[model samples]
Every structure is written in C-alpha cells, then in structure tokens.
Target: MVTAAIGLEFVKQFLNLNNPPEFVFACCRDPATATDLKEIVKSNSSVIIVELDVTKQESVEKAKSHVASIVGTKGLNLLINNSGLINSQRIGDVTREDMLKCYEVNAIGPLMVAQAFLPLLRQAAGQQSSEPMSCSKAAIINISSGVASITENSSGGMYPSRASKAALNMITSNLSLDLKTDGILCTAINPGWVKTEMGGPNALITTEESVEGIMSVLEKLKGEEDSGRFYHGVKGQTIPW
Candidate 1:
C-alpha cells in the first residue's frame, strides 16, 4: 500500500513531463492482490509492475529476469532503492533477531539490488541507440533517514534502524567509488519526515510532497561526480555524515 501510494504519486507527476520516461513498479507481493497498483499498471501501459522481494536474493534474481525479458539488453536508466522497514525498539529492549532483520532489509537489500541490476545499468550507460541511453547516465538512489546521522536517540533504542541506515550510507559511498568507472551514479537521499506508515501520523511531510521533492532532486542529477553525496529532499540541501 505504501509502495503503491508513493509510486502512483511519483509516476503521475513523471508522466506529466513533456517527454515521459518509461517506468516499472516492483513489489514483493502478488500484483493481483494490489488492486490500486494494478489500476496504475492499466492506466499507464508504459509502466510495468513486477514482483520483487529485495530482502531475498532469489526474488531479486526473478525480478531481474522479468525486467530483462521486458526491457531487454538496453538496461534501466534509473534504480530507486526505496525498499525499507523500521522497527521501534529501545536499546535495552532490542532483540538480536530484529536487529539482523533490520540490517538485512535496510542495508543488505539495496546492496543486493544494486549488484543484481548493475549489468543492465551498465548496458543502459553504453547503449547509444535509444533515448534513455542517449542521456548516457545511470543512477541508483538509496532512500535513507535522518536518524542515521545523530545516534543520540539511538543509544537508548531503535538501534537497528539507525545503524542500518548508517551502513546503507556507507554502502552508497563505497558504491559511488566502485561504480564511478562504469558511469553509474550511486547516492543516498534522505526523504525527510514524510508521513507514511513508517513515519507515523505526526510526521512533518506528506508522501506526495516528499516524493515530489525527491523526484525533483532526481531529475536534476547529472553524472558520477554527483554520486556518493547525501542529498536532502526538495529543499536542495546536503546532509552531513
């Protein structure tokens, strides 16, 4: 539901462009169960919905296959690693299992997705035959959080989410260096206090506004030189490590 809402808003604005970009919305659950998302797929024939479980390697591979079969060797121009989960637990109350689960989903998942989809991204960078390829740039956007920066609150609890996001930031920095030669820009983006299922009711921003600001930032991303840095939403600011 969260994925559908965010994707719908982003795609609605994205399709409004003078030249709309091709898009795909991937999820772990069956598409048949997501009627609202299915409506999006129906309304936008250009948008493809695929089943993807970022936490599972097999699921990621299956998603890659589905994408390859649909888009072919040309590759994807942009990859948004927006899949994440948050658990509210205090430090003394934290459990080992939950900590591992948080790391798997928040940190390792994006890394797996990046590794799995890199060939296609590299292909997108190399292909000169198409419009997306004509741009000659591929980017990976890792959605992160503010808690990753200040761990004061984390010391008492919520260690998993905070620590994992920090690790994700590190992964983005490292990937920016590793993929620079391939012309794949990898960066972490803090979406701010958006009111989603995870962000709760009192959050400062709505998902629509947050995504709008994020898309704006993404549309302006140029090349590998912009990789590895941390960007805050539509305010056009950078977050310190």
Candidate 2:
C-alpha cells in the first residue's frame, strides 16, 4: 500500500481484514514526513514504511530492492499504485508544466514502478504452480479516477487531470495484456469523489466509504476475466473507456 489520504485508508482496512497480509509496505515519497502514516502503523510490526518516489526511476528501483530483500523468494503479491497528482487547471489555464507533471506522476509513474517490480511479481506468479491469477499470487491495481472516462465525460474541464488519468487507464490496459502470460492481473479503479485533499470536502463520499467499496471490488477480481477493466469503486460497475 502507498501512503496518502486514500492510501492510508487502504492500509487501515487491510489491517482490519480477518486474514491480514503478512507485511504491508506503506510506501511514500518521504517516510520521515509522513507523520500521520507513521503514527497509525507504529504499533503494528507488520506495517513497514518504505521510501518510494514513483516519478523517479532510481527511487522506484531502490524501493524494489528493499522490498525484494525483505520478501526474498516469496516475492511480492500485490502492488497498489496509489500515488497520484491532480491539476485542476482548465484548458485555458493549464500550462505545459502542469500537463507534464500530472502525466509524469499519474500515468508514467505507475508504469515505471510496475516495470521495476516486474521481476518480483513474476517470481510470485512463478511460485504458484497451476493456481488461478489472483491478488494473493500477483496483481497490480492502479488508482485512477472516474473523470478519466472519455465516454462518461459530460462537463469538460481539468484538462491535465483528465488527460493524465485517461492515459493511466490506457497504461493499465496495456499492463494487463503484457503481464497476462505471467498470470498477473492489472486493473484501474476509480475510488469515486471521496472527501480527500484532492477530492475536496464537497466530494460525494468519505474515504472509508470509497475504500470499503474498492476492497469489495478487489476481493472479487479474477484472472483475465476481470483484467484490463475500469471499475467504479463505489458501485462495482464497469466504466466505459
């Protein structure tokens, strides 16, 4: 899991699971600065805070190495690309810097992280003899947004955020196909208009509500049957690309 507003909720929910993960790497750009994240997981020995900057390849590789060292032959089972950046600028106000930065963080970052962690994901998948593709074996979940849906777009604005997230949706689809042979499932999930710094206080749902819905959808994901799909986290409904 990654550490952010919604990412923190995921960590909490995962911890509360009846059968919690053996270890949850609460990754963030700077562990030293993530006071809230640190405080919540301090008492739990299983939650390990990792320093990871998704936008930087060096940082991604470093985090991968650290995780690989710890997980050893067991390898990693699940990777949630929960890191994101939002640029709310409209077409007239959006700049090249805004567009590029959002694209780098929201679209390219997940791809880079997945590339760096492919060996571990493959290692975990290879360990599963003839078992079906599942998160327990290996899976990549990209946290996307509903605004990325081109088909569902009614009001047009937020050029950077919309475009970058749309690109992310495409990346998720490609990853699903590319990693299918390795039995790795990849999917993009829209956590809905949650009440977070990004989502704003006027958002439709709470972080708990959004994560609960996301967890429900994730729990039901199956092999190729569910791969490469865009989902509404709150409703568990498919969204058009």
Candidate 3:
C-alpha cells in the first residue's frame, strides 16, 4: 500500500520496473486528478491505482476496507507512507493555512495510513517467508525529510516543512516500538535532495537513484533493532533524528 503514491518518483520508478512485489498499489489523493503516471500505468498491469485522501479519517477507513477486500487474509507485505506536502520559506510563500496543511499531510497523514493498514501487515507476519521475522520482515517506510533535523538545521527556515517532518520522525520511532511485537519493521527514510517537483531541478540526485538505494536498505531490514532509525536512502547512511 503506497499512500499518496502516484506523483512520487519512487512510485513512478517502482511501477515502471518489474520489481519484487507482484502487485503494487498506486494510491493518490484523487485518481482522476492525477495527471502524471498515465504512461506508467498504461503499460504496467501490476500497478493498481487506488483513491486515497490521507487527511480524512473516513477516506482512510474506506481505503483500508477496499485494500482488505483485495488482499483478503493473505495480507499486504509493505506499506509506504509516501504522501507529503511542503510549504516553502520564501517570501510570501508561507501562511497560517499552509503551516497547518503541512502538519495535516506530512505528519498526521502517515500515522493515519499506518493505523488504518496495520491489520494487513499483521497478516503478512503470519505467513512464511525466507527470513520470517529476520531482516526481510514486513515493513513500513515513511518518506521523511532532512530539514526535520533540528541539530543540523543550520540553514533554519521553512518551519512548516521542517517541524512537520520532525514530528513525522517521532511518529516513526513510536510506530517502530508500537509495531515491534507484530514483526513490522517501521522506519523513516529521507530520500535526500532528489530532483523532483518538490526537490527542484538543482537537487543532487534523481528519484530512481533514491528509490534504488532505499530498496537496497529495505531488502535487508533486520527486525526490531532496525526499526526507528532515520536513513538517507540515496546516501545509504543513517541520519540523526
């Protein structure tokens, strides 16, 4: 389950390639409103576009039910809370409404998605796999940001984006502990300054590079001990939370 999935480069690259997961959900706020990914979806039979509005409780509940109906008792292997928003710090760019909006989408949204889809993740734990409860455990990847780090915030600005992502980091830590017994390895990952709609053209890397690096880390996520750590997906290193 890829929450707020369609526009992201990670989702785009993942869908384009024939990867490990047999079926992938291209979750978006509005499927009809998503102008991107049309080309990617047309060729990829495995990609399933799901309507999901993370900010709303009712919508999340409905999405969870719909996913449950499809996966049934077999369960979902991975849940990536990739939905987020950023309000720039540039002059006249930030506002009271935008600040609240940032919190709604970036921080609370991931938590809500996790809460809604937890049952299916537990179902995955019940099934047998090579690692079982080892490195290859069921996972929840939260797309966090480096701007969230207070200690490293030398350039300090964009309080809405920064503070919200910081809150998201905390949520990720809490989830790691909360879901530990269920064998779900929940971790927050910063995809780095990638060249995307949000990252802008001057960003250091591309989405494919970021996703590839992230997948490598995810492919070997050890159980409880590995949870809660902040990772730089592109750099393949741990970031201070």
Show the lowest summed lDDT stretch of 10 residues, model 2: 1-10
Clash count per candidate? 4, 0, 0
Return whichever of 1 and 3 wins on TM-score: 1
Stretches of model 2 off by over 4 angstroms after superposition: none
Question: Which order, best to worst by TM-score?
Answer: 2, 1, 3
TM-score winner among the candidates?
A: 2
In terms of lDDT, the poorest run of 10 residues in model 3 is 128-137
Q: What TM-score fits each model?
A: 0.90, 0.97, 0.89
Stretches of candidate 1 off by over 4 Å are 1-4, 128-136, 150-156
lDDT of each prediction vs. the true structure?
Answer: 0.76, 0.91, 0.78
Clashes by residue pair, model 1:
27-52, 90-157, 91-156, 91-157
Q: Candidates 2 and 3: which is better by lDDT?
A: 2
2 or 3, greater by TM-score: 2
Ranking of all predicted structures according to lDDT, beginning with the best and ending with the worst: 2, 3, 1
Question: What TM-score would candidate 3 get against the native?
Answer: 0.89
What residue pairs are clashing in model 2? none
* Per-residue lDDT over 1-241 for candidate 2, one digit per residue giving the tens place of the 0 to 100 score: 5658899899899999999999999898888899988897778888988999888899999999999999999989999998788888987898999999999999999989999999999999999948888888899999999889999999999899999999999999999999999999899999999899988889999999999999999999977899999999999999999
